[model samples]
Target: MEPIVDTVVIVAICVLGAALARRLGFIAPLVLLVAGLGLSFVPGLPEVHVEPELVLIGILPPLLYVAALQTNLVAFRRALRPILLLAVGLVMFTAFIVGFVVHALLPDVPLAACIAFGAVVAPPDAVSATAIARRIGLPRRVVVILEGESLLNDATALVMVRIAAGALGAAVSFWDIAGQVALKAGVGVLLGLAAAVAAAWLHKRITDPLLDDAVSLLTPFVVVIVAEELHSSSVVAVVVAGLYLGHRIPYLLSATSRLQMDAVWKLITFLLEGVVFLLVGLQLRDLVSHLEADVATTFRVTALVFLTLVAARFLWMYPATYLARLFPRIREREERPPPAVPAVIAWAGMRGVVTLAAALTLPRSANVPGDLFVFVAFAVIVLTLLIHGTTLPMLARGLGVREDTSAEDALAEASVQHAASRAARERLEAAADGAPESVVDRLRALTDSRSNNAWERLGSQAQETPSAAYGRLRREMITAERHVFKIARNEGRISEEVLNRAQRELDLEESQLNRSDD
Candidate 1:
C-alpha cells in the first residue's frame, strides 16, 4: 500500500512538473530533476531508492519503443552511416578509452571494473538528447541521427557491460566475448523481426482500438522478456520490433486506432520520462551518503571521467564525419556536412537515466567496499543533464547550426496535400453518380478546404488567409456550442451519452483546427 501510494505521488509530481516547465519555457526533464533534487533534501524525508530492475526492465523499453515508433524511417535510412558510427563505434571507443583512464587514476580497481563503469555511462539517453534537440530546433537530419543512434547504442553498451561483468569473475578471451556479443545481437534482431511481423498480422485482424492499444503497449515488454530468456540483447529486440511495427501499422490500421495509439503513447512517454529524471536526481542524496572514499578524491575522479567522455565524443565525430569520404563511391553518394554540424552533435551528448540504471546493476563484489562507480555514474548524469541540457540551445545558436527548413517543409507539404486532395476529389466524383448532389458538394468543399489550408499556410504571413478565418470562426462557434451543450446537460435537457457524443464531435473539429495552426 505504501509503495502504491508512493508511485501515485511520483506520477502526480511528474504531471505537475511537466506543466510547470512548459509554462516557464523550459524542458520538463530539467525542471523535474531540480524539483526532485530539492525534494530529496527535505527534512525527515525517507530516502527514495530507485531499483535497478525497475528502470532497466520496466521504464527503459517503453521509452525506447516510443522513440523508435516516432523515428522518421526515411530519414533514419539516409543517415544510417553516421548513426552507426556514433551508436556503435563511438560508444565502444568511449568505453575503451575511459576504462584505461579510470584504471590509471585508480589502480586498486580492476581494469574490468573500470571498463564496466565506462560501459555504464557510454550510451546517451534518448529522452535527454532528443528533448533538448527538438526544443532547440536542431536540423531534422541531426535529430534523426541522434534518434537512430540512441535507439541502438544501449544494446552495444549493455553488451559491453555484460562482458566486462563476466571478466570480473574469471578470465574471458577477447574472441570468445566477441563471439558471444555477435550471437546474442543476431538472435535478438531475428526475434524482434519475427515478433513485429506476427504482431502486425494480428493487428490487421483486430479492429478494436482499445484491444489494439493493449497489444501495442505489451510489445516492448514481451520482446524484452523473450530476449532475456534467450540470453540476447533485449534493447535491440525491443527497438527492432518498434521500428517495424511503427512503419507497418500506419499503412494497415484504421485512423481511429492510430489516433488512440499516438495519444496513449504520448501520455505514457511524458510521464515516464519525467519520472525517470526525477528519480535520478533523487538518487543523488542517497548516493553521496553511501560513498566509500573521501569527497575530494571522488569528485576529482568523477570530473576527469566526465571530461574524458566529452572529449572522446568530439574526438570521434570529426574523423567519422569526414574520413568516410575517402572512398570515391561514398564521396559521390553523399554531400559533405558543414563543419559546425559535428560540433553540435558532439555537444549534445547529455547522459540520463539509462546510465544510472546500468551502473546500479554492477555487483557489490565488482566495486568492493563502496559503489564508487555508481556514484560516479550519477555524477556524470547530473553534470551532463544540467550542463549540456541547458547550454545546447545556446551552443547551437552560436555555432549557426540551426536547420532552416521552413520553406522546404511548406513546399513539400503543399505539394503532397495538393496531390492527395486531387485524388480524393476524383474518387469522390466517381462514386457520386447516384448520390445526392448536395452531399457531393459538401464532400468537395471539405476536400478543397483541406488542400487550401496547406497552400494558404505557405502564403505570406502578413495577412489573414481564408483557411485561417475559417479556423478562427469555427473555433469560436465551437466554444459557443460547447457552452450550450454544458448548459443543456446541467439543466437535464440532454442525456450523458448525447452530451458525450456532441463533445467528441467538437473535439475532433478543434483537433483539426489545432493541427492546422501548428
Candidate 2:
C-alpha cells in the first residue's frame, strides 16, 4: 500500500491492459478504463484517488502538445470560424443550458453552484477525443475541430468555473462574466506564446538529440506552470507552445533528433493515453461510494444532463457548420461543410478529466452536495466515453467516413523525401572528384534505390503499385537472405559480428518496404 508501490501496480495494470487492448483489437483507452474498473473491486485493494491538479499539470501538457503537433496549423486556421464556434461559443452555450437544467431540477442547490458544475463539465474532453480520433482517422476537418476545440475549450471552461465560483451568491449573468474571462484568457494566450518562443530558442541551441527530446518533454510543463502562476490558461499556454513547436519542429530538429522524437513521443503517447482512461475508470468507486442524493432523482438529473450534453453539441454543430455559410465571405473561403462531418463531430463530444478535475475544485462553502455533483460528472463522463468513444468507429464506418488514402500520404511523403534525396545526391556529386569509384557506385546505388521507391509509389495501381510489387520481391529476397544468415550463424560459417551486420542490412530494407506499404 505504499504510495510508490501502489503507483507501480496501477501503471503495470495499464501497461498490461494496453497490450491486451491492442492484441484483442479493442480501442486501448476503452479497455484500460474497463480494466481499471475491474481492479477497483479486488478485495483489500488500496484506494486510488486521481488528483485534479495532477491530471491538469502532470498529464494535460504532453498529450495536448502531441495533439497540437499532429494538427496542421494552416489547415486549422482555414477552419478557424467553425472551430471557434464549437470550441468557445458552444462551450458557453452548454454551460448556460446545463446550469439552468441543474438549477431547475435541484433548486435547493445555489444557482451559481449548479452553474459552476455545468461550467466544469461543459467542455468535451480533449484527451478522450484525441485518443479515439487519431486511431480512427476522422476526416481532416473533423480532426481539426475535435482537436482544436479540445485544446481551446479547457481555458473557456476553467475561466467560467472561476467566475461562477466567485459569483456563487451573486446574481451575475454568465454573459456578464464573459468580458472579464476573455481579458484573462487573452493574457494567458500572450504569455503562452512568449513561453513557446523562449522554449524554441532554447531548443535551437541544444545539439544533442537526447537533450533536445528531454527539452521537448519539459517545455509543456514549464509553460503550463508559467501560465497558471499568472492566473492564465495553462491549457492555452501548452496548446500554443505545442502548435508552434510542432509546426516549426522540422526546421529546428536534426534528422536524427526528428527520428528519435517520433519514436519517443509514440511510446509516451501510448502509455499516457492508456493511463488517462485507466484513471477515468479508477475514479468510479470514489464518485459512487457516497451517494448523497435520492437514487431516482440522481439518475433523472444525470440522464437530463447527458441528453443535454449530446443535444447541445448537435444543435451547435449544425448551425456552426451549415448556417454560418450564408455569409459570402465565409462560403468563399471554406469548403461547403459536409453533412457527415458534423455527425462525427457531434458524436465526439465526450467530456473527460478536465471536467472531473474541475468538478473536484468546487468550493464546499457554496453549499452544493459534493457527492451529487461528483457523481453526476462521473456518470456523464463514463456514459459519454463508453457510448461515444466506443461507437465512434462504427459510426464512421456506418456513415462511410474515410480518411485520406495511405497511398495519397505515401505519395506526399515520397515527394518530400525525393526532393531531399536529390539534394543529397547533388552534394555527393560535388565531392565526386575526391571520392573513390567504389564509394561513388555504392552511394549512387542507394540513392537510385530510394528514388525508384518514390517514383514507384507515384504511379502504382491499387495494391499492385510498383512499390508494392517491388516491396513483395524485396521482402521475399530479404527473407531468403535472413534465413541464410541465420543458417550461417548457426553452422559457424559466419562470425556473430558479420552475421549481425548482414542481418541489420536486411532488417533495414524490410522496414523500409513496410513503411512504403503503410
Highest-scoring model, lDDT: 1
**TM-score (all chains, Cα) for each model:** 0.97, 0.90
340-363: candidate 1 lDDT, tens digit per residue: 999999988988888888888876
lDDT of 2 at 66: 85
TM-score of 2: 0.90
lDDT of 1 at 113: 75
lDDT of 2 by residue, 1-518 (tens): 58888778878888899789889988777788788787777779865777888888888888888888778999878777777787789888898889999999988888888788888878998877866877887776677777789889888888888888888788868567678668877887798789778878977898999998998888888888888888887777788878887889888889878878888999888778778888878887766777778899999999999999899889888888888789998888877856888888889988777788888888875368877888899888888989998899899888877686667876887888889888989989998997789999999888877877777766736568655777789888898988988999999999999998998778767877787676
Compared with the true structure, all predictions reach lDDT values of 0.88, 0.83
Candidate 2 residue 87 Cα shift, in angstroms, is 1.2
Model 2: weakest 10-residue lDDT segment is: 458-467
